[model samples]
Target: MELELRHLKTIRTIAEAGSLTKAATALGLAQPALSAQLRRIERALGGALFERGRYGVRATALGELVLERARIVLPAVSELQREAARFARTRRDGLRLRLGGTHGPLLGALVDRLADAVPDTTVTTCTSWSERELAELLAEGRLDFALAGVCGSAAPPDAPQLVWEQIAVDPVFVMLPDGHPLARGREVDLTALADEEWACVPGDGCFGDCFTVACARAGFTPRRMYETDTASCVHLVQVGRAVGLCRATFPPTPGLTTRPLAGTPLVWRHLLGWHPAGQRAETAATVLAQARTAHAGAAARSDSYARWLARRAEPQTAVRRRAGLAS
Candidate 1:
């Protein structure tokens, strides 16, 4: 079919937003014009590209298949445009980049590395952010890199728009009051605590749908009676209002002990999230590179905190002290 970059963008926008009207507002096109644009493309393809329903315009099977390839088209075109400009200003332009992440320790080390390695670059980072808000800001040219947890691998597969480079794997644990019953257990499984009240972030937030998947794999959906996407929920758990699921690497707060679930997969992945390709805010790549390495080294910190977590899933006395926590 005779499709172009704009058509591909229209499809991705509709898919991510789950509605034509919202995509229109984001893309700054009138509703009629957007509708006609999609219709013409589907005509060329000899099939409907989007399914209209109560929720919004969702990609048809064909549209879903097309999106796999189309997702990269726009980004490749944007990068091509920028490469020419970059070639011209190879040695003269300075990089001004902004990076954001919720997994703080790893990224903070990355920024320090970037400062030492790339003196010409200036990067500022933030932890504890909303993915939707961060994605919006990054798309609108406000931010560059995002250090989020891993996203699912359910893409159409042909397009291959994302790359997940794992920096570290940390165990999932239950955050409980200082003296909760399960606090002293070396490890506890979800099935064992099927009846405990749970506290977690909303489904759209970081621990969203994935939490349900993790719990399902553990043999039960959590009895999540509370759903506040903040650290305050940890406080709720502390006061006996709810219990929480947390990765050892992304602790909600102090005095909340974490014990591993005997048979669950580790849900903590430190991921470096970025646009596949786009008109980035100048210094995005340099910052992203630093982040990837920072997570690697932070994971390798041979120190007490690292050993301490290892101790939790085993007898604490088995951990041998490793120095170098300072820096």
Candidate 2:
């Protein structure tokens, strides 16, 4: 009953065509249907909107007033719709990247690489301690990519909507104060720290349980486990209140040292995840390559990891040499 935008559009069409029959054709409606609709529209406005004649149709005084307003309102509404469409397109194709991650150094490294590779891109980041939170954000289209880690051979978060790719795998390491007795060693046995308290940043995965299993395998139950943020964990280790468990790629701290577990009891895998159906999926491969490069750069910067790699390669190199000598 009330005047609506469609009624205004119909009025504008009739005025522009100068006849109901012609307007009906332009609007793809039959003449009778168009005439009926116009009657309803005019009745809703409480007056006749046109004066019909033998030659053609002309506007009455009321029709002229309605047509004048329709001219303004219809064009403005059309322009508004066009501008809205343009704004949507601009946002969709503007090379913006929304990245989410759990706490880690690799996210920052990945951001740095993206900045260098695509100078015009607008990059944003969201950080959380829980990998599930990041995965959910990606599924909800709030984030373009998610960077997180999982324990050795453990499944990534339970987001079937996302595709997870492994960027790198790292051996889990232990952090000790510079003055700790085990800090002098190249590697420390998990059992060697049986009586010491432990501190680790909390995550929404089974990693904590995995650590506990590793300790049990080493023949001792850790005395007291502290779940805290990364900074607090670092402080606990630095002040010798508790040993910290960290990835081998953890950056060096002034008062702390990181060493690999003697037998590599634990491992961490860096993952990059994205919704397979999202617009960002088109660039997923390129972004994944950049992430791998960033991870490699991080590993290269970790002295302990570099030494571990060298030592691991030594055994393989000696085996190759022995086989060649025998041959």
Local distance difference test values of all predictions, in order: 0.64, 0.88
What are the per-residue Cα lDDT tens digits for candidate 2 across 1-327?
Answer: 889998888888888898988999999999999999999998998899898998668888999999888888876776566445434534675588888988769999999999998888898999999999999787666788899999989899887558999999999999999999999999999999999999998998889889999999999999999999899999999989999999988997899999999999999999999876664445788789999999999999999999999999999999999999999
TM-score for each of the candidates: 0.55, 0.71
Write down the TM-score for model 1. 0.55
Task: Please name the candidate that would achieve the greatest TM-score relative to the true structure.
Answer: 2
Off by over 4 Å in 2: 1-91, 280-282, 323-327
Candidate 1 backbone overlaps, count? 1
Name the lDDT of candidate 1.
Answer: 0.64
Please estimate how well model 2 matches the true structure, expressed as its whole-model Cα lDDT.
Answer: 0.88
- Going through the candidates in the order shown, the clash numbers are 1, 0
